[model samples]
Target: MIEVAAAIIENEQGEILIARRKKDKSQGGLWEFPGGKLEPDESVEACLKRELREEMNIEIQPYESFGVNEHDYGSVHIRLFAYKATFVRGEIVLVDHDRVEWVRPKALKAYEFAPADVKFVELLERE
Candidate 1:
């Protein structure tokens, strides 16, 4: 099973950051809480920080454990760890994703998310 870390990065205005997967990638064109798979032996917090920096060119301080979800896409099974994080610094840059957006929690349902990430949207919306 692949271990993934996803960040629910909230800005000062209380908007969360979500990214759109590149059209050619797995789960393509879907919006997801920005994060990535964990490197071997890496802690979830470290993985979250590293992934956000590498993929989005931003630094984040992961402060709380939001939730977790496991899903199988037939080809691959992933256990996703969601963390509540604060955007620390750096200019936003898209590396693996096509676009990024800061959206209100209640508005997240309007975007189609990867299956594993769908649970988080419902969780956030109730907040």
Candidate 2:
């Protein structure tokens, strides 16, 4: 299984941040939490921080893991680790995703998510 990191990134207005993937990405054009693959010897929190920094040009304090989701996308299997985090600081830099949006928790369900993110969204809704 491929280990992945994802964030339930929240903003000051009590909204969550979701990124729209570029058409070439694995789950191209779908909305997903900002994060990436976990590197060797890296803590999951560190992976979350590194991914946000690289993918979105942001710094975040990923204090804890709140949920996990697993899914298969035909070729590869994914193990997504979801974290509950506050946006500590960042400039809106779109490196991988096509667009970024600050959306309400309920509004998040409207977007198409990768399979693993479907369950993650349910966890978000439960909050």
Candidate 3:
């Protein structure tokens, strides 16, 4: 299984940040948390920070693990580690995703997300 890390970022307005997948990429046109696969021997928190820097061009302080979910996308199997984080610094410059947006948690369900990310969304809705 591919080990991946994802960020659950919240803004001062109580909105959650979600990124849209690039149209030409796998899982294209779907919304997902800003993160990527964990590198070899890297901790989840470290992986998340690295991914945010690379993908969003921002610094993040990941606090805790919110949850974990597993899913299969045909040939790809992923084990996702979701962490609650706070945006630290830098302007968000989308490199992997097409766009990024901060939305109220209640309204997050309106956007379609990857199957693996759907579970985390449901968990947030419960909070």
Candidate 4:
């Protein structure tokens, strides 16, 4: 399984941060929670912090484990860990994704998110 760590970053206005995948990427043109694959010897927290920095150029203080989901992309299987986090510092500078947005949970369904993220979006809507 490919281990992945992502954050559910909530802004002061109570909107969640979502990143848009580049058209050439695997899950091209889909929106997703910002994160990356976990590396060897790295804890989920460390992986999250590192990914946020590398992918978005921002820092966050991860709070609790929000949820987990798994997805099968034919040849690849991914196990995703979601965490609730608060933005700590830096302006978001997108490096991997093409766009980013702060959206309300109710509006989540309006965007085409990765399959793995759909469950989390449901969880958010239910809560």
Which candidate wins on TM-score?
1
Count of backbone clashes for each model?
Answer: 0, 0, 0, 0
- Residue pair clashes in candidate 2: none
Off by over 4 Å in 3: none
Residue 125 error, candidate 1, Å: 0.4
The runs of at least 3 residues in candidate 4 whose Cα sits more than 4 Å from the true structure, single-residue gaps closed, are: none
What is the per-residue lDDT of model 1 for residues 22-103, given as tens digits with 9 covering 90 to 100?
9999999999999899999999999999999899889999999998999999999999999999999999989889999999
Q: Model 1, residue 29: what's the lDDT?
A: 99
- Regions more than 4 Å wrong, model 2: none
- On TM-score, who's better, 2 or 4? 4
Local distance difference test, per candidate? 0.95, 0.88, 0.92, 0.91
- For 76-101, candidate 2 gives per-residue lDDT tens digits of 99999999888999798998999999
**Candidate 1 regions off by >4 Å?**
none
Candidate 2's TM-score: 0.95
What's the lDDT for candidate 1?
A: 0.95
Which of the predicted structures, 3 or 4, would earn the higher TM-score when compared with the native?
A: 3
In candidate 2 the C-alpha lDDT for residue 30 amounts to: 92
Each model's TM-score?
0.98, 0.95, 0.97, 0.97
On lDDT, the candidate that comes out on top is: 1
Q: Using lDDT as the measure, what is the rank order of every candidate, best first?
A: 1, 3, 4, 2
* Residue 62 in candidate 4, Cα distance off native in Å: 0.7
